[model samples]
Target: MSQATKRKHVVKEALGDFVTPTEKQQIVKVTGSRGNNLHEAVTARGVTFLVSMPPKFRKNLWIKRGDYVIVDPIDEGEKVKAEISFILYKDNIQYLQKQQLWPEGFTVEPDKEPEKAEETEKDEDFSGSDDDESDLFVNTNRCNYQYSESGEEDSQEEAS
Candidate 1:
């Protein structure tokens, strides 16, 4: 059958009404023009339903980003088949339904500026000199100290 004569079945979950931090959301019914003839098969509240409406109905509802709608299978206008969602980021309805990411309500909180960790530096006290020969200074670029003995620490290795 042609696209206009075809009915699309979907299970959309409402993602509430509010701008979120840019994430994939629900699929909404795109009602065509006057007598556009759009059909849908839905399931809600443990019961299946079917709806037949014009594509213009969808646009009039402003099924834009982040809008919650319902499409009932049986007695559509008289029943609730599934949550209405805007079909976004996909060409066909089936591709959008596969996402299944829309949550019942707003589960995520508003964006908050991340706090930067504060850094404090306290002087280290190495007052007493206890020489452990094993103190091989692998990292010396970031350190400043004078060896009282006045001997290059790695002289032995150089001589060998």
Candidate 2:
């Protein structure tokens, strides 16, 4: 087929519904690019290795650091041990998490709620202050001028 048709097909397949990894495939977090369509990634078990991006996904899909992808391991390569099969999006991650298929190391903690509550309390406490010193540094550089019909300045006022 044409190049455009191939790209469209690859993109559609990459973005299609989430599919669970097979026996030989596993999820990995991309660490950095290794050049020549090769990427360095870490698996859920903390093993680091290189993965090759397929030609179809080379330009159609862009993978970056911290992005998760499912990789199929290769038995022949020494340095490049895997090939990326699918790139995970937010929805796909959530779906995998819901199905209990997501790795525990990749789960996000919900510890920010208490921090947000503390910040709101601090803001409320500061809002109750009536100190006039807070306005000591008010901007006084504004100038408003009113012009008459002749275009001459009639009056000038300094905005507070």
Q: Pick the lDDT winner.
A: 2
Estimate, for each residue in 21-128, the C-alpha lDDT of model 2 and write its tens digit: 888899999999989999999987789999999887978899999899999999999999999989999888888989999987777532465788999999978976
Residue 1 lDDT, candidate 2, scale 0-100: 92
Model 1: per-residue Cα lDDT at residue 139: 73
> Candidate 2 — which residues are off by over 4 angstroms?
109-160
Question: For residues 1-160, what per-residue lDDT tens digits would candidate 1 score against the true structure?
Answer: 5433333222122222222223332223333222333333322222333234435344333333232233323333553333333333223322333444443222231112122111111122342245655767577667767667645657866888
Worst window of 10 by summed lDDT in candidate 1: 109-118
Candidate 1 deviation (Cα RMSD): 18.6
